[model samples]
Target: MTALQRIEQGSALQQTDDADLVARIDMLNAIGIALSSENDMPHLLERILIGAKQITRADAGTLYTINDQQKLNFEIVQTTSLGIKRGGSSARPVQLEPISLYRGNGSPNNKLVVTYCALNNKTVNLPDVYKENDTGFDFSGPRLFDKKMNYRTRSMLCVPMINHDGKTIGVIQLINKKSINGPVAFDDDDIHLLQSLASQAAIALTNKRLIDDLKALFDSFIKTIAASIDETSAHTGEHCRRVPYLTLALADAASRDQKCMKDFILNKQQRYNLEVASWLHDCGKLATPIHIVDKSTKLETVFDRIELIDTRFEVLKRDANIARLEALLEAGHDKDRIELIEKQYREEIKQLTDQRDTIRQCNIGAESMPPELKERIKQIAARTWRNCDDELVPFFSEDEINNLLIPYGTLNADERKIINDHIVVTNKMLASMQFPDEMASVPEYAGGHHERMDGKGYPLGLTREQMSVPARVMAIADVFEALTSWDRPYKKAKKLSEALAILGKMKQRNHIDPDLFDLFIRDKVYLPYAREFMDPELIDIDEPSEIPGYPFDMP
Candidate 1:
């Protein structure tokens, strides 16, 4: 043949190979997409295990997830079914029969030569378990063929799943690739390609683990901060913890209605920004002072203004007794009869004590005080405690924001103003902090947390339309954590039921977006959350959903 003719024919062959290569790339890409898309590990494993069998045209396969202890953990995410007669066309989804699987070869006696992969961290391929190197788990596959419904293991391939850290997360085993009514062993090319896929899968799994670890760390830091806030104020001990939990719950519900955060184009930096937004939602609290945050009673810190009313009672008792004695004397009662007049003095004192007790009753109660109660407090406080020896006792503590007049969300008017100003603090804190260029938007997401749906929220007052999806997600996570946490002292920790109900009402009143609340209710997102922080015994699924409106916030 002419040289040109030879080159043309060679080009055609190369083109065919190129087309096949493209097809393989597409398949691998699809598998990678499936693996990385899910946060749930089992589902991800199922997808890969099924892909491994179908791509290799194998009859059965097993996927294992290895732990830090160098053990194999079988995922219930994948299962098997046998006894399918070729002509008996069945119409049911294949049942994944429960395979009793464990981490590490349970007693190390099984012949899957787990040691083979452990030592080599490489692929093992066999033409048949009945012959050849009998070193691995091959014995079990063929034995199953011999004992169960008649089938023989013709070829087997096993590959280690090594994460990015160069540690093996687990192994993937594919069995019996059929070639013309009999099994065919996997070739070098198949092993090489499968190895590549396994490597990619490992990286994805490692990514997920890192995410989980980061979240745990963030939660730990927030818990420590909440404890500090609690410790700073006598009355606000638990408030800091509870608010973040509630905020997170609310944010979770809101996300369902709002946009669920999307993994942005696999950008690591963007991923970081999303996480930062959630963890630092309450970093703004660091700017708020302790005395202002935990102020419980209206007249707290400066004095137990109640003491002033007691003084008034004492004066009233003295006046009443003096009058009663004077009347008795004017009526011709002599000094010898003074003991009879003294009885009236004792009765007056008893009445004043009873009235004082009633005034004290309404002060400590958590519920809202009506105008009558307010008026009563005003009248009694006006009476003056001549005993107060202070300049205004400093209510502001380092970690606690105790402003009694705050009426109990966390800050009083000036304190609330200071607390709200934390948005500015967060904005400045995050904006000045450097991040990789990809996550430059982190500060934007973090700072807008206090912004409201109605443009009434502080700092920016961003409406729902103006907020980014990341900010919305932060908003949910922030609210959920606040409501459900046990670290706050201002109020009792709200159960998932109470928190959701409150969020639902907020959504109804236009304070929070509604769609996210629906998602929070439907997905039971709090189930996993409850398992994380609360004692299992305290988790009450029957928690009441009755959310009474905040008297002041209600229209």
Candidate 2:
């Protein structure tokens, strides 16, 4: 009977211990929520420290992170009344020992200690610090105990904060367990609680580190790309620089434009796309030969077409000479015939000089090719002169070279096509690109910049209904920069009044959204935008167009 009673008692004791362990698990859960939710790292650490002391009945606590150099560092992230209050700021981190220090080989005196906790990546319990050999290294962490903090050392229970990657970030050392009634064993319950909290802290620290690293890399990348594009040309100056600024502005504008743009609101993912789009919109221009982009006049490529007309003048001169020579022969008037032919030559030359004036101001049509112009080509073909690399594809293809005829802007027809195709190239280039999950929408948004409200845009003429908010925002920013920018190849910039008037007309034509334009100007979006990237001379309101000399009609 006595033996049986003793067995029953042992069983009961085991059950009680299990219950105690389970309760400790529940308490740790409560503390985990608090630690994880707290954005203030110091406060979270302090709360966690207090919870640790409560679980273990520890007299004090200290947390330390190991540095890349494998040194033990202090992070008095939290502590309880061995009576020290956390110094208002977060504790400076130190590294006295690394993961390397924890193995049995490193001299304990040669470096800070990483005991059993570091080796197994688990908790280590010591009933009394005074009884053990001092591992030959400094174990000092600040304390609130009487006298010198270094003088006090006691039993410690430490847990390593090992992240999912199996890297140990720091160690939580619970020192001097003390119960209200008296000292209690730093039992399994206490070990379990500290381990759980350490786990949570590990994840937070790892996440913070990853996020910081990514941000640094992204900023560096943005700066490098911007610098590279700026190096391309003097004209692309402030123009490219202002893209991101205005993109953000348009994003904000779109954000406030009610539900019409509700789906386009630049959430986290959309903003990421905008960031890449704004930087890379003109990337295709990088591939374009320099002369074409800056082809200030129609004849700019290799030979001025105007010069070809001069050759026609040569033909007309010969024709006049032939007529004079024939007339003199018939009249038997040789006395002044040679001199008369020479005078006729001079008169023909004078006529040809003004011959180019009419053609220079000829009416260029829209993108469409005009049959009349093709016929004119036949008449002008008779006047061909020096041809040098004239047939090369200087710009993009056009059906009828409509805009070429009108010269609404400086672009003679061909240069206009090259400029227009920039968007097409932008689309094709971006289409092949692969943005990460967070930025997957980039190709669509950047490519849609030229899209019109009435489906009149090129490449893909997605109507306003099909266009995304990001695309619309890009459109607004693109136009805003083109109008207000201080750099370009041709044509003096129109007054703000004129630029806005054109955009307003576009709005009326259903080529642009009226509400968005109104919002853009009314908000004075360009004021601060100009401040950010415009050169001092360009920013001056007095004919801001003169700096770049707003293209008579920018291609």
Candidate 3:
């Protein structure tokens, strides 16, 4: 051949090399971006191995991450020739045991190639494992695997993944560099490309780990606050914990409802946010007074004031006995007069006993106080009794009268206001926090649980139109949990049938979301929750049709 022709041929070869180098660089850039963007650990690890194999044209690859125990854990394993895939997002799990960094004798286990690469922060490129006798690393495990799979064990490359902090985080092992002709060795270019991929993978893995650790810490902190709120009241101690489970369950059910909730769906992040919001829903109850929270009766404060009223009744009986004795002394044993005085004394004692019993019953608050009962309380309070100072005072205090006259539940207007203020505090507390963008709606979701659809709710009277679906879902969960919780002091836990009946009424009155309530009943979301958290006897509903407000034709 002519010298000029030879020079032209060499120039053409050099140009081809330059073009290939550019293509490989472009591929590396794309792979780096892909690795950094992945948030899921398993998928990221899998992608790292797959990307490595693609860049090096390898037949198989395995990715190993260093666990907290200083051991190499097989995160991803794939072999194209064998069509074997395990770990990561694969259904098949890696059954291989972890490679310990240290042996039983407390010495670094550098006998294996992957571990040696990780410990020394070096790369080992074996042209052929079968031919290499001076490498000083054990290939027995690969040999055994190859023997079992009926495959040749040749051409190995192991690279240590070193992060920005100059610490080795994992190892990547590639097998059998493949060409069009056959399996070949991993050359210098292959080593450099694998090293670059390993560096990016290391950073991605480390960032994910940091973010996960932070997330774990944040979740624990939120739960700790919830648990502290529960600790404030024995009667409602489980309220904070149970609401989250019920909220998530109902939310999931709503997501599946195609009829009414066709547009309602919670993505993974949104669902996570809802779960977090549910956990923090009642965090403000942490500031509520324990006395008011555990108030079991109308006249309850620090303790039951009914016992004090009992003392007063005893005082009145003593006064009546004194009067009866004085009258008998004046009559001087006159039979008719003595009989009349004794009869008068007995009637007075009976009336006072009746009045005392009435007061005791009123102190035990009910769902509603009868007007006649209130009048009765007032009448009894009008009667005067001598105090320790000998001054005449009404039988019942004004404060006690007001407490006994509470129309519903144990809390009076002022006490109820105090209780309602917790939602406001919850909103403020959550608003003050700088949550991530995905959880920005947590404050609204958590605080709006008490809101009514008719714009009559407290803290913020958000109408149904103004509230989000998650908020409404949380409201239903809150009420249902309260209704079925067995730990309440004043009222017994209602059976599932009764709770559903009441919830149905609530839906009709626009107190809760109608669609979500229907979905809750239609899907039987309450059944699983009831079975898990409620007493088995409380689940007494025989049929859905028996429940009040249940639409018989509901799809």
True-vs-predicted CA distance for residue 130, candidate 1, Å: 0.9
Tell me how many clashing residue pairs each candidate has. Answer: 58, 32, 0
Candidate 3, residue 413: how far the Cα is off, in Å: 1.0
Candidate achieving the largest TM-score: 3
Residue-by-residue lDDT tens digits, candidate 3, 1-555: 899999999999999977877788788889999988999988999999999998888999999989889999998999999999999899999998999999998999999999999999999999899888887888899899999999987899999999888999999999999989788999888899999999888889999999999999999999999998888788886888899999999999988878899999888888999999999999888888989999988889999999988999999999999998889899996999999999999999999999999988887777677989989988888888899999999887889888877887889999999889999889989999999787898998999999999999977899999999999999999999999988876678988998998898898889999999888888889988999999898898856777864444566
- Taking the tens digit of each residue's C-alpha lDDT, what string does model 1 give over 1-555? 999999999999999867866676678778888888877655666677777765666777767766555556555222233533111122333343323224344643334644466446767888877787646464764577557766665677888889766777778887777568667888765687688788887887788788779768865775676566556657544545444454445444444343443222324455555555555555666767765555544444444455654565676666687788687877574765566666766776785677678555543434344666555544544432222463333222222222222343433466558867877877787777666676678687778766667878778878988977556655655566666665553455676666666667777776665545445555566666677665566466642233334322211
TM-score of each: 0.57, 0.63, 0.97
RMSD of 3: 1.6
Candidates ranked, most accurate by TM-score first: 3, 2, 1
- Output the worst ten-in-a-row residue range by lDDT, candidate 1: 395-404
Candidate 3, residue 245: the lDDT equals: 95
As a whole number from 0 to 100, the lDDT of residue 420 in candidate 1 is 75
Q: What is the C-alpha lDDT of each candidate?
A: 0.61, 0.64, 0.90
Q: What lDDT does candidate 1 reach at residue 144?
A: 70
Off by over 4 Å in 3: 1-4, 549-552
Q: What is the lDDT of residue 384 in candidate 2?
A: 37
